[model samples]
Every structure is written in C-alpha cells, then in structure tokens.
Target: MLSITGAVANSNGQKVFKTLKNEELHCSEAEMKAHLANLYEQQKGKCAITGIAMHLHGQDDCDSDMLVSPDRIDSYGHYSIGNVQFVCRFVNFWKMAQDNNRFAELLDRVVANRVADTV
Candidate 1:
C-alpha cells in the first residue's frame, strides 16, 4: 500500500502511471467538446428562469459546470430534451449530486392574459 501525492509526474510518477494505465474508463478532449455542444443545444442557449441568451456551457466561475444532467432515465428525468434545463452554474453542480426534475418548473412566462392586447 502506498500514497500518491504532489506534482503528479514528478512526485508520484509510478502511482500516476498505474492509475493512468488502469482498466477503467475516461473521456477525451474531442468527446468533451461534443458533449458540451450537445448540452448547449439542449439547454436552449438561454436561462431556464430568465429565458435570455446569456447562458454558456464551459468557463471558469461565471458559467462553470453548467450542464443539465438527468438523474432518472425512466422516471422523473428521461435523459431527453424535456427533462433537461438551463440552470444556474452553481445549481447545476450542486444538483449534480442530486435529481433535477424536482426544480424543473422554474421557468418564466409572459402574462398570457394580456395576449389579447395585440390580437
């Protein structure tokens, strides 16, 4: 048993190598880019509550970790467009460890009663 720490390649090269060569799975830059693009489209390029186009997918702090992850594929969220939403960056990450549909109805709407004002 051993503990790996510090500058990765410098302080724990052997351990890092072992972990890197592990038979587990992982993601590549190309795949990440594609997934982010899909997420951007699914979230509608707008805020779920504001409905404005000020939302973005990847960045630091401002729009960091802003992805709509569906927890249930057969229940609350079916991993489809309907189950997805454009949420705040903080909420996105916080909900990452939880379900999303519970707060899915946070969308804004115009006063439908005034629809006849122009019609």
Candidate 2:
C-alpha cells in the first residue's frame, strides 16, 4: 500500500486521489491500507480479472504472476477506494491503461485461441 500511495503522490508529496469522473478525493496512507485489506478480503485473494489465486509479496513460492497487485479499474483515474481492485501482477501489466471490460474480452479471446490450438 505504501508503494501505491507513493506512486500516486503529487510533486508536493500529497497523495493525488481522483475518481474516474475526475473528481478529487482525499486518501491517507492509513485509509489506503485499510481499503486494500478490505479489497483483499472482498476479492477472496483472487485476481479480479483472471480469478487466479494471488500471493502476497515476498512469499516463499510467489512468482510474478501470482503476486497481488493493486490495479485501477480505469487507468485514467488516480488511486481511490472505489477505483482500485486487486489483481495478479501479470494481469495488471497486460491490462495497463485499457478499459476493464475491453481488456477482459480480449483476454477471453486469447485464452480461447490458446485452448483451441493446444487441443
């Protein structure tokens, strides 16, 4: 959560919180931490997009793909409670700056094609 908060901090060192509608919101580190914990539980330790189980950072067997990452549902939006979701690190990287629904559709197609090819 610290990393995420730091990433969204403005030049003045204040966290820049914005909704998808471009409305400004205020979020402190403590708020972010709590929000993230809630999201982790709400998501059942799975990636929102891929539904794959996620592992905490620095776990003994955690790989990049299995690591949990905080993702903004709308890439254009800043980090806010409503806009953030937990996802696999690889999924987050693959979905960067794309609309969530569109990315999911694309991912589904890719998976289907891969399955067909393998079969």
Candidate 3:
C-alpha cells in the first residue's frame, strides 16, 4: 500500500512538475500514504465509488475489481490531500477523465437499470 502510494505520488509529481512547473501542488508520498491509510479506515475498507470491499495489492488471490486504487475526486485537479480518494481499481479505470459526480450518477443509473431488469 505504501509503495503504491509512492508510485502514484511520484507519477503525479512528474506530471504536475512538467505541466504547471510546480510539484508542490501535489501531495508528497508520505502524506498520501498517511491519507490513504486514514481513508481506508474511515471508509471501512470499502471502495469509495462502489462500496465494495477493497484489497491491498498482492493480497492473496484478489481480482482486479477488489484491488484498492487512489482516484482523483476531480479529474482535472492535482493529486493533493483533499482531492484524492481510494476506490476500486476497476471504478478508477471506468472513471478516467470523466467528471467524478457525473460518473457516479452514471454508475448509479447503470446499477439501477440492472436491478430493474432483474425485477
């Protein structure tokens, strides 16, 4: 989990440095790791988007959907302290570059439709 945070922070730092010429806008790896750990506890180890239980990377026999990933709450924003959340890996992929609230609404609709169809 710590390593994942480090990788994400490093990657985002590079992007922010290159684009805005200000790496300080992004959270440091240590800060991100601590934040994620707090979020994990607060979220009850569930994905922020799907409410599904999440597994740390390399946990035994977990699928991609169960993996925890750091997602930017605002797609256009920097990876700062208040801007990031822990979500399922699949949800993060599905939400790429989309407005976060819009994507959540779309996901809700999809689940609603699926439930309706089942009924």
Specify the highest-lDDT model's number: 2
Q: What ranges in model 1 sit over 4 Å off?
A: 1-25, 47-86, 93-96, 105-119
Decoy 1 TM-score against native: 0.32
Positional deviation of 27 in candidate 2, in angstroms? Answer: 1.5
lDDT of 1 at 42: 66
TM-scores of all candidate predictions against the true structure: 0.32, 0.75, 0.72
Q: For residues 61-87, could you state the per-residue lDDT of candidate 2 as single tens digits?
A: 888777999888888887888899999
* Alpha-carbon RMSD, each predicted model: 13.9, 10.6, 11.2
Model 3's TM-score against the true structure = 0.72
18-93: candidate 1 lDDT, tens digit per residue: 4332221135556545665786676576655334454344644444444443232223333443344455564554
Displacement of residue 40 (Cα, Å) in model 3 is 1.5
- Residues 48-91, candidate 3, lDDT per residue (tens digit)? 87788998877887897778888878777788989888888988
Quote the positional error of residue 48 for candidate 3 in Å.
Answer: 0.8
- Which model is ahead, 1 or 2, in terms of TM-score? 2
Candidate 2 Cα misplacement greater than 4 A, ranges: 1-25
For model 3, which pairs clash? none
Residue pairs with backbone overlap in model 1:
none
